[model samples]
Target: MQYDSISHFLRTGQEHLAKGPVALIFAEDDVEINTTLRHHLDLGFSKVVLFSPAAFNIAPELAEKCPRVTLESPRGEPMFDAVNAINDAAIGVWLYYCFNSEYLLYPFCESRTVGEMLTFHTEERRDAMLTYVIDLYATDLETNPNAVSLDSALMDRTGYYALARNDPDNHNHPKERQLNFYGGLRWRFEEHIPADKRKIDRISIFRAKEGLKLRPDFTFSDEEYNTYASPWHNNLTAAVCSFRTAKALKFNPGSTFQIQQFKWHNSVGFDWHSRQLLDLGLMEPGQWF
Candidate 1:
């Protein structure tokens, strides 16, 4: 089903909004649209919705399967407004959002479904799941000028770090369980990237509630939802192996010429499995074992 606008989707697409664990995909471009939808559908989302401009060429079969919302401008503020509206309409549902060329990876995701992970998380009283946006790019930018080749996708195995999240309202003291995570392509090419867009941490998986708003920084209106874990112990964390950064850096004229190749001594082939991310300390199983 296709909706002409976000408001149209909210008004008449309530059936799709009825279920929990819905995957909200915002397509910045046509890059890997089909594969992105396929990955999340296979991950077991109850409903998968695509927000893309009409110009995008979506596969006929996928077009028939997923609800597509016609979004003239799908980035920045418009994207956030759409999400907030959907959150209001779909209260109590588990929601996850990402762009094209991004795939979600949780501990034991290979064997277990995303629904199973969320069930376990809900049992732990978690309202949101923190995800690291690990940058993926092709080793040879010459062959794939866009820096997006899933077959040759490489990611930084190291360089990830976290710092205390300070609260402005609380006299600069660190937040209880929240931290500002950084690294990946953003950290390495900080000069080209804007300061606000550099953080790799995103609370991508969350529960929708009344008055819940997704902030510009990719955090949330609720402080607890921004936390990495519960007060008692560490909870499950996930990683989103993405080519978004790679695509941006390579497409932007300012940085495109400067970056000859994304590969480096620390670069490693992404195995597309949970175990590799776990081994690299990119994500944690917490107490899910």
Candidate 2:
């Protein structure tokens, strides 16, 4: 089914919304939009909802597989408003949100489905999952000028760090168990990126509930919702190997010329295996063996 507006979809697509573990792909300008959709579908999402303009011209075969909705692309605060709108209507469903060219990878995703991970997460009494945006770029920028190549994807195997997340409302006392992660492209291209946008942590996967709110910083309204790990143990953490930042660096007219190349000696080929992220401590596997 198709809708001209998000409101229309919310009002009419109740059956699709009822399904759990729904993946929302808000395609901004990703050249790898199809791959993004395919990744989510392959991960066994109960339903995949796409919010993009008709100009994206989603392939016929892919469009036929999921409900497509027409939405004017958002600017300024990214997709905060659009994602929140969907979250408001997605109560009781485990929702995952990301832009095009961003892939959702959880611990041990190679042999397991996202559903299985969420099931174990739910069993641990967790309603939200923490995910870090690990920037990925093509090693050969000229060959893949768009900065996205599933075949030649590369990521920094090191350089990730975390700083205490300070709460202004609480007189600057640091939030418990929450840290603003930084590294990847956001680190290398700091001059072009905003301070708030530099944080790499995101609460992208969560079980939506009444009054649940996603802030501009990729955190939720509930304090605990912003945590990166379960209170009792070191629960699993996920990462999104995103080309969004690399795309911006290469495409943004102001910064494009400044960034001559994205590759460096530290870059390593992404083996497309969870083990690489696990070995680097980028994502935790929790109790799963």
Candidate 3:
């Protein structure tokens, strides 16, 4: 159920690598580890691989179902490297990666499983799926100092936008069908977040292949995997409802005292449904009617 290290898992945990649609959850802290694990498990993933530190407390039942890899420090480059390593090992498998406290939301997810969605996506010839990381936070930071409360979660309904993704190698021409999406907590708190980390667009659901590398910027070595859709029409896009930003701002000494609250006039309670996200234009179902 657990491995001593990433290498140890790769060497002996080949059974887990045999399947498709595995979720790789990297826990930076102990926050919401059980719920996050349970969420993906409920999504019908073939395997849920958790990379967490030894000190983090995990629910006994969840610990039995999910494979936990002992990762003392899961952040920055190391996290990306681990993803790349696993990706290389599980060639052709559909892989989804996210941090703890993040939940994946696809259209009609209440009834349809993630595997079903991927099946439809694959039929359309898409090797990857674009997802927006919608920032979620507790409305009252005074009571929830960490700015994370699932019950009190709020998200900006009107802050999302996207710009052309320019290709430097192609003389700065915009990449076809690719856009650098922005907004959520990153856009609102730009001072605290680095410019490079401000984009919300991520190819979160992708098929792993030989030599596939997940970059530190949350992209892949294969440029096509970074596209938002196929050249002809719009494709399905998912949303990752996350409290990672809110938690980070409160955790960091620099921004902790500055942000007393995360709510505004435009802030609305997250309904935790794909319909609400679709109505807000956060994600699209495309041709998946």
* Superior candidate under TM-score, 2 versus 3: 3
Per residue, candidate 2 scores C-alpha lDDT tens digits across 161-261 of 99998989999999888999999989988999988899999998999888888887789999888887777888879998899999999989989989878
Give the per-residue lDDT digits (tens) of candidate 1, residues 1-289.
9899998999899999898899999999989999999999999999999999999988899999999999988899999998999999999999999999999999998889899999999999999999999999998999999999999899999999999999999999999999999999999999999998999999999999999999999999999999999999999999999999999999999999999998999999999999999999999899999
TM-score of each: 0.99, 0.97, 0.98
Clashing pairs in 3: none
What's the TM for model 2?
Answer: 0.97
lDDT of all predictions, in order shown? 0.95, 0.87, 0.92
Please give the TM-score that candidate 3 achieves against the real structure.
Answer: 0.98
Q: In every candidate, how many clashes are there?
A: 0, 0, 0
lDDT of 1: 0.95
Q: Candidate 1 has what TM-score?
A: 0.99
Off by over 4 Å in 2: 74-78
Candidate 2 steric clashes: 0
- The lDDT ranking, best first, is 1, 3, 2
Pairs clashing within candidate 2: none
